[model samples]
Target: MKIYALLFLVLCLSQQLHAKEIDVYAFCDASTKFLKKLSVLPLEDLVAVKSAIAASSSLEELSVASGVPYIDWIEDTQKQLLVSESDAKLIVFEQVKPIEFSRYSRVINMHGVKDHRLWDKVLNDCVSVNLAALID
Candidate 1:
């Protein structure tokens, strides 16, 4: 029993030490302008953003929409990543306001209109670069 307990503790400690850290960024729209803006970001920043997004739990969004218990989870996850609400970037093409957890760095209202051309441009760019493949 003692050896079993020691082995379990060692395994747990090793896993924690090897855990990957992630960074979170909030984006409103997928547009060329937004993509261009992101292109200037440091490679580390981009990696962190991707890691955070990939690790993010969809349950949080569901909880937000359903009025469920997500605050604790969000807070805990953000804490783990050392990201504050102010540090999170919110990028969007529309005039939509940023949410509580994010800060808007650039917002192009475009008269409340959305341009699919820009959207498609961004999507095509993403596909060409295989950005989705990097998420996991």
Candidate 2:
């Protein structure tokens, strides 16, 4: 009985240890980039991104922002609608279901990797909107 219980515990722990990374963070990041390039985005999206960034004090974000006014403004204003969905539950592989990411983050590339070929495929399969067409 003791061995069976221990084995069960080990299996449970192993499963959790190997749980897949949630797409939420990746989705958020991609959405941020996509929205920034757009000339227009919903007010709610801007709110969410701003809220997330505001709530964080990471040196990485600070350094990434640099000192450009337009860049800073873009970072804040592009994520308005995406904010409302920020409270939704983050799903895992076991919960596979069609996800309608926020309008700001409508496009997603599921090919990101953390292995040796990572640099070769940064945003490899991500969608690229035509900013020129939208502006016209």
Candidate 3:
């Protein structure tokens, strides 16, 4: 009986862990250069990239403004874009989604690439804004 109870607890804990979803933002240029570079990255490299992006002052501001935590970066691809279901919110470049990322509660579409300085304003206008609106 104790073993069965332990198993149940483990299962419940695992489910809760998986429930925590990370928001993934896919950024790309007109040629999808950034996206292409991102897609080929290994899992470790991806995590490193996430850490680096999260560490950026600009992205930190964006996270605060958008009220999103754990934002991961990925490259958008035609094949990956076909799948409609995802556990993460997607902030994609304009016209990148062919099927539409309906799974995510928030799908932010950014217009033409902007300099870091303008990113805060863009995110504030398109999404949400907070004390971190000003990016230095």
Candidate 4:
């Protein structure tokens, strides 16, 4: 009926209002301290960890390997929150497209992190474990 339709629309709008998103570029800039430290290492050493990252079966495993705790990464990006799912989807598409990243590990390593100074909130904490795995 008309009333049910109205209620459904209202619910959808409310969910959209509560939805959140992160800007990939901005997030990369925030940078985790752990990842910043890794950036200082020789590229070969960093590349050497690729196997460990790939072997990890879960985020917790990757977190342990990298010494970065697992947290709700996207939600933690308070600076780049987006209410619209469409915008978030577009951003994700732009960053992950043109090439296939079947695994999370591959995607995380391809995008170098940002952040030089060891700040209060390390990019490692706010990012997905896959990215953090490359830190150590």
Say which candidate scores most in lDDT.
Answer: 4
lDDT of 1 at 77: 35
Q: Write the residue-wise lDDT of candidate 2 on 1-136 in tens digits.
A: 1222232222223233222432323433464454344314455654554444444343244323222122322232234214322221121111111111222133122122235343223233221221221223
Per-residue lDDT tens digits for candidate 4, residues 1-136, read 1222232222223234331332322444443333455555655655545555555555454555445442333222222554344444443333222111122233245335453433333333334432332232
lDDT of each: 0.34, 0.29, 0.29, 0.37
Per-model TM-score versus the true fold: 0.25, 0.18, 0.20, 0.31
In model 4, the clashing pairs are: 31-123, 32-122, 32-123, 32-124
lDDT for position 43 in model 3 = 50
lDDT tens digits by residue: candidate 1, 1-136: 1222232222223234332331111111323355445545565554554444334445443334323343443444345446663332111101111121121121221222366675555445434333232243
Q: lDDT of model 1 at residue 49?
A: 45
lDDT of 3 by residue, 55-75 (tens): 434434435433334232222
**What lDDT is reached at residue 40 by model 4?**
56
Q: What is the model-wide C-alpha lDDT for candidate 1?
A: 0.34
Candidate 3: residue pairs that collide: none
